[model samples]
Target: MAKITNETKRYPTDLTDEEWTLIQPFLPKVARRGCRPQADLREVLNALRYLARSGGGWRMLPHDFPPWQTVYW
Candidate 1:
């Protein structure tokens, strides 16, 4: 595997493949299946960071993280 580069370095929001792989084991097994598949961990974490760094309410997070309402409260 290639070494981590500046652009690929983990931020408070980003996750590397290996990190994702480790977490994959714990991902919830949901009941929904689409014709396509998606894993949006980065999107959600980034949203979380936006809230954390900005000191904004979690409801201020982008719609990408749908649990934002509960997160805020």
Candidate 2:
């Protein structure tokens, strides 16, 4: 897991380390054949949770989360 830099702002919906650990196993594993790197599952989950909790539109998601299209995918 990548160490979160202190510079990265934390969002209200961001999962705690324990929460992420519990859910990490259920997330899909990265395919070895992909040319591009996989997006961080924690960030993706955080984005989804933010959307669910805020009831915000995809375009209106805060800049802190991954791009809306990525989360949508």
Candidate 3:
């Protein structure tokens, strides 16, 4: 799979660096064991924000964001 990058702002729902800084402290840290996470938390959050703001179906999510299943569950 190609590497995913959260460096660019592709949507209006994406968090600004300052916003992420304020929100980052509240998110859970990665586990030291078990399966690693498949997606970036910030990207997932942005997907969610886009879905909420647009009121679109999960499967209809744009190609730029992570897969819909990743954001849905």
Worst 10 residues of 2 by lDDT: 1-10
Off by over 4 Å in 2: 2-9
Query: Which candidate has the top score in lDDT?
Result: 3
Candidate 3 residue lDDT tens string, 1-73: 2222367567778887777787889999999999999888888888999999999999999987889999988
What ranking of all candidate models by TM-score puts the best one first? 3, 2, 1
Query: What is the lDDT, from 0 to 100, of the residue 49 in candidate 3?
Result: 93
Candidate 1 off by > 4 Å: 1-12, 32-42, 49-54, 63-73
Q: What is the lDDT of residue 47 in candidate 1?
A: 58
Candidate 2 residue-wise lDDT, 1-73, digit = tens: 6444435538767787768778889887777785654567788888999999989999998887778998999
- By lDDT, rank the candidates, best first: 3, 2, 1
- Candidate 3 has what TM-score? 0.84
Native-vs-model 3 lDDT? 0.83
Which digits, one per residue and each the tens of the lDDT, describe model 1 over residues 1-73? 2233447654455455666657657865545765332435444545566677778776566554536754443
RMSD of each predicted structure: 5.9, 2.5, 3.8
Error of 3 at 72 (Å): 0.9
lDDT against the true structure, per candidate, is: 0.54, 0.79, 0.83
